[model samples]
Target: MPIVSLPVIWIIFIDIIAWTFFHLFISAICMRLPLAFFLKDRLLFQVFSWEKSGELWQRLFRVKTWKGFLIDGTIFLKKGYSKKGLHGTRLNDLKIFAAETKRAELTHWLSILPAPLFFLWNPLWAGWVMILYAFLFNLPIIIVQRYNRGRIAAITA
Candidate 1:
């Protein structure tokens, strides 16, 4: 019997389902509770903080204008997507962005799964490819939320 190979694209497709499943699951929980309990509070959130000046790594992600085009998560993000159009003068808008950023960060953590889970089905290439696909899909939204929140935080300060 010949061993059939699974394509990387298939791994990516599974990545989408895993990503969205966890996305919806976590989002629903967050909607119901203010738990705000990330698995590792400081380690996960702070590691991705990039920088205030942002030259080292944050520069790699899209600018505000360019980012709006990617998925326009400003519109699609569940909680505060609606708040984007609100004036910065509104302190509540800052709160909304903060809440939404926490939700988006939850998805980033969710993206880290599936790779390990995929190892059960595909121990070699598929597992690694799924990991890459997960990061590629999730990181930008993470960056966008972080960047936008930093700006919003400044305004509300």
Candidate 2:
């Protein structure tokens, strides 16, 4: 049987908007507050840290090929701006990149919340697709954040 049903697709559409908007709001709050600083010390952050995902294949994914054109194209994540806001030493960049990575990782974790909420509607394929899209959109950014953060951490350490 098909994973998604036609009747539930509309609910899935709304779920997608909610997923994105929720993260955007969370991102804004993170920018204003020191959530990243707090999360840095939390046990939860450890699971999402760079060390867990760092590997030969992960490095290969972050390479500046076609994938970079899509994820890093964002104005904020543009080029090396994420690590160095145009001017900063590698160690200083680590501090900045650390915070960025924390926020992205947090946002990625929160992205899955809406999927189960929508599952109450019927546990259809549409909800699953939204969850999958959330992963697709967030995972690359998360990988990039962790990849660069690892480099930054090395320089600072």
Candidate 3:
């Protein structure tokens, strides 16, 4: 039920290009937001009692087994805290790392918000695919951020 149409190949190309742009655009904007906005645990980032300091993700997704394999977005942006690994063991460093996780999580979540816009030009199935792509591209990063933040909480608590 798209309002416009394009060939399958064009759709694929656009999907790739558009998603890349969306990710970078979102990250760029998020990086400019005040650090204080990400310092607090609120909304989607709050760790619940059941999470057990992110061990939930380890049990459910074996996050540790694959998390290291995921690309660090900081590599693409060339600015921002690196989530590739913890940079320091000091308390202040850990706190900053935890805050950056919140920022990273929000960025990925925001990146997914534009998936519906793909529907304007793609076929119904392709639009659904775009939504799927959006989640696939961003969700793992969100999961990592949440897990890392939870671990940091365990450390700081």
Candidate 4:
């Protein structure tokens, strides 16, 4: 089969690069706020906010609980468990926090793809390309979430 035109390939590459950069910029802006605030305000819990799920998992695992989502952030739970009993200072809590933070970071990074750009043009190929890229980028997270759920189930069992 004949190869795609150089211009078309260049456009695709530009789209990918532009989308990636856009996501990175957006994430940088959003990360400024406390992630828990975002999780609470965004109704992220309904979506099974990684943070919430992680907190649940840590409680299941009997790990220490910490505050903030990122490793670079402050760790608040060093003493008695919080009044709510959900609070505890443990390494597992910290791990869950870090993992959820990374998941959020990854989601933000992937959001840069200009999903609307495909709609701007009527070309069938453009739509196909965007769909393929979206599936490719999202598959990993889907798999990981499934795997984590399974792990949680096993631990609970």
Best by TM-score: 3
Model 3, 13-114: lDDT tens digits are 988888889889999999999888877767777887788999998899899999999988888988888888888999988988998999998898999899
Each model's TM-score, in the order given?
A: 0.65, 0.65, 0.94, 0.45
Candidate 3, residue 48: how far the Cα is off, in Å: 1.2
lDDT of 1 by residue, 23-98 (tens): 5665555455453453224444543335563333346654565665555343444553443444555676456656
Worst lDDT window (10 residues) for model 4?
A: 77-86
lDDT of every predicted structure (CA atoms) = 0.57, 0.55, 0.88, 0.44
Weakest lDDT window of 10 consecutive positions for candidate 2: 77-86
lDDT of model number 4: 0.44
RMSD of each: 5.0, 5.2, 1.2, 10.8
Q: Rank the candidates by lDDT, best first.
A: 3, 1, 2, 4
Pick by lDDT: which candidate is best? 3
Candidate 2, 1-157: lDDT as tens digits: 3444446567557665776677666555555556447336456544345364454325677333433454432244222224323235655545765666666666666665655555555455655776677677777766666665555555555
